[model samples]
Target: MKTKISTLLLLPFFALLMLTSCQQEVVDITPPADSEALSASSPLTALMSSASKMDGSKDNIIDNASCLSIELPVTVVVNGLEIIIDSEEDYKVIEAIFNEFEEDDDYLEIIFPITIITAEHDDIVINNADELKEFVDECKGENENDDDIECIDFKYPISFSVYDVNFQVIDVITVENDRQLYKFLKRVKNSEFLASLNFPVTMVLADGTEVVVNNNEELENTINEAKDACDEDDDNDYGDDDFTKERLDEYLQICPWVVHEFKRNNQDNTVEYQSYALNFKEDGVVRMRARNGDILTGTWSTRVTKRGALLKLEFDTLADFTLEWIVYDIEYGKIKLYEEGGNRIIMKKNCDVVIDITKERIENYLQECLWRVARLQVDDVHNEKDYIGTPLKFFANNVVKIRLNGEFVTGEYEIGVRNSGFFLQIFLQDRPNLKLEWLITFLEPGLIKLENENNRMVLRRHCADGDDDINYIDDVLLTWEWEVALYQDGDVNKTEEFFMYTIDFLENGWIKVTDPNNGIIDGNWLAYRHEGLHLGLHFGIEAPFDDLNHRWKIAEITQSRIELKDLNANGEIERILVLEKKE
Candidate 1:
């Protein structure tokens, strides 16, 4: 008996939320124009309400309802086989069972006493089939137009300022997800208070493109234009199993798909195949780029069957990917393919991935600028700390050098080609992490990703040669003798600890601190631009100064004074440090 298991919550309605209790934090508000506010009758409000509506079509296989979703963990009997569905992945199990026997009539029976969430996110308990059927009867026929706008979604935590009847700001509410947004909007729709969305709110289209709208007009126009941009997939099918062969083929060929997860015959091969890209061409041809910069050719085809959309790939050397895979789930920028016996492959579309990688191109990109060792993990041990303040420079003569503490350490580097792919080998004494024959897994204009058996390294290009900001920061630090003027550690006034300490920012990536008693403490410091301008300090357990060691955001900088602050994940200031030039 072939039956499919509904694995997990495929849509928002099935997912529950644990709403966080927020405290009222008063902030400065700049009220927008009347037209910029979100009112009950605004078209943008309607679009948002529609977009926030519960999409119940995802679990149609179990409930057969397009406006309601059965909350898990629901028990069901598929062809007399009792199965408990706890998550969305179980959907594949049920579908796999159904595809097992093509000739048998697949039937499913739901276990009673389950909860169903309605289109308005209301929960209703059903004890038996009669009660469930009555609610199901109220739902429109499959694929009919519904109140929910499935083609777009709001990227939370979007915030809105709630005002009193006079438009005086009262409260600011932050919504974490769709449910919370919908509930908040319901209050706004009822004219509870005048509310305006915070500017620069992000709206996600059906195809995963994010549009940031600054005001009400832009928000309204964006929602109206994207409401019907893509297929809503508001049918009874659990996945995109109803997609035609032509549609499936076209989707795969739109961009190169990079292997995110792979399992072959019950064995996890994700790391081995991760970042291996496959580009499906028009003429049944597919090109796979291996991690080592090697490209392999293969043949691909797709077909629609009673089971679902099927994608077949044939590659002589790539045996793991040579199978007829069932296209179980296809989402924005991603596709999930699986087969019986624990074989599955999850690929994500990457339009930026270059299929044709060459040695000259790699060398040219590396030589354009200095590369920072942004990330380094060898045998699960993070070693990037040792490479701090160090940047690698590549030259045309296969020569590479790392600037360590203001000194250049020369090394020989080579871009080697092999059957597996491209490999980068660097011969530098005392730097064992960079000595590995790393396979170049990913490469772009400003970034290079490399890995080996148990090591991974990510290098970000840093072209500081003509950067005005870097020059200004470097000149400011080197030209002045500074002292800790203010150090606020969570409201504590600890500035007096370093009353007479003089600081010198040396060009050799060293910070020399002289005490009032003529004692000196040496430390490492680097000023760089990432996300913003930052000053990285490392004192290595030196008293008082060690406490100031952190990658502090350069909040304010000038010839006389420099202010740096440590920010929390929410972009809130946690600590403040001020450095004033000594006369």
Candidate 2:
């Protein structure tokens, strides 16, 4: 079976549309202007009024309340023996008939006592009271003893009632048999009719067989043929087997037989069986092998309680037997078989079987494992500067080595200004060396090496302050000292004395004089001074010399001093006197 979960996703949309449509139609009705102006009655209204009056009346009036008595037809069949319905009447009428039959010799003797089963009212719809009354009158007859008979056997269950066109409640009739009557009375109470007359019908004889006729014409023809056959069988027994077989043959010739097909199977032997297609005569009773072979013939019995068909099987010869059969379209074509208190087998159409995962894909998935390794190295060097400045060396694609020494350090250099000068130093495995120093005044762009080694080097651009014509020298030069004396006595005492000194440079037209007794002085002081000289003196007690230029100025003066002349032009002096001090 196919099953699915269904959802009404659009139900609200349809409901809203229905609500809108219902709101558009409007109906209005106005009542008559006054109730007094309305007419009291009309012809159709009178007829309805009469119908209501008749509905309140009853037929059998016993005391103040009206009583109702009804007779019904009944038939009974027991084991294929049909008990036909002959006459119907109320309780009183049937009692009278039985009493009359007991006294009359023309009536047949009562072989079986009339058995009372049940009495009940039939369900009916009556439109008016007249129709109910008519139904009672026709079934009861006039004065309860009329010769008109209305009840007859029709071979099936039936009931009758009377009603008007409006389908209102009228009287009702009930026809039942012994089985139906027993079931009916067991469900009800206080039954009235004790018994009713029912006739036993005989089969009509044609040739030697029994036949059935439904109408009068056919019944009469069957009776005449039975009379003729009776005369020919004066010496034969009517219930003998030969007579029965002959009757069966004649019946088969006259009546057509219907055929139906039933298929079966034997599960153990794997065989199939089937019956000829036959018409449904009555409830078909049959037993067939599961392998499509007829095994037995009997009445097909049905279990009303279980709601399933039953089959009986018996083996004619002694052999181990197994039976398997399939009934189609029962409980939606699902066949379940049970044996020994458990389900033995089950068969169904359109089932699913499943298997999982393939092998090649699993093998391919297992082959995908990998391994890898990683290595690391680190170095410690004394010449970090050289190592950083040196060009990167590669011994091989994956290996590298760096070598450095004091003399030829395989390292790098740095070119930049330092404390003493603009310098370049090399980083090496040993101590690093300064490659070059350009004095502040002598900075230039060139290549330099550290410690006279070409292994560690640098190229740099240097700068300084001066005219471009300047040159620098590395000279170990000595400084000069000077002393001075000033005399306040004409005797030239050394007690009052002071000394001063200065230096000079001869290159690049620059000079610097450094002195402790005097402040720093720049420029060529030798060219500016006329009479003063840089001097050194010895302190002693002696007469001050009047020849000042001859004693000190001769050795201290590095350049010649210019002489001054007298402007008056006189050639000789009278007294040759000089300042000489007695000490």
The weakest ten consecutive residues by lDDT in model 2 span 369-378
lDDT of 1 by residue, 1-583 (tens): 0012222212232111211122243344666688878898888788888888778876787888978888889999987899999876787667667755434688889999999988777778999999999999999987677777887788876787776545556566676766776777786788755688888888888667889888888888888888776666666666665577878888899999999999899899997898999999999999999887788999999988767789999999999999999998786798988888888898999887888888888888889878888899998998776666667889989999987545778999999887767889888888877888888889878789998887989988887678799888889999999999999988798999989999998895778899899998877677788899888776656788879867789999999999999999999988999999999
lDDT digits (tens) for residues 67-164 of candidate 2: 12211233323223334334332322322332232223222111122321111223344344454445444443222322111111122232322122
Q: After superposition, how far is residue 322 of candidate 2 from its true place, in Å?
A: 9.4
Model 2 has an lDDT value of 0.24
Question: Which 10 successive residues of model 1 have the least lDDT summed?
Answer: 13-22
Estimated TM-score for each candidate = 0.58, 0.14
lDDT leader: 1
Please report, in order, the local distance difference test score of every candidate based on alpha carbons.
0.81, 0.24
Candidate 1, which segments miss by more than 4 Å at Cα? Answer: 1-63, 67-129, 138-141, 144-230, 237-242, 376-382, 405-412, 418-420, 427-436, 451-456, 463-500, 506-512, 515-524, 527-535, 538-583
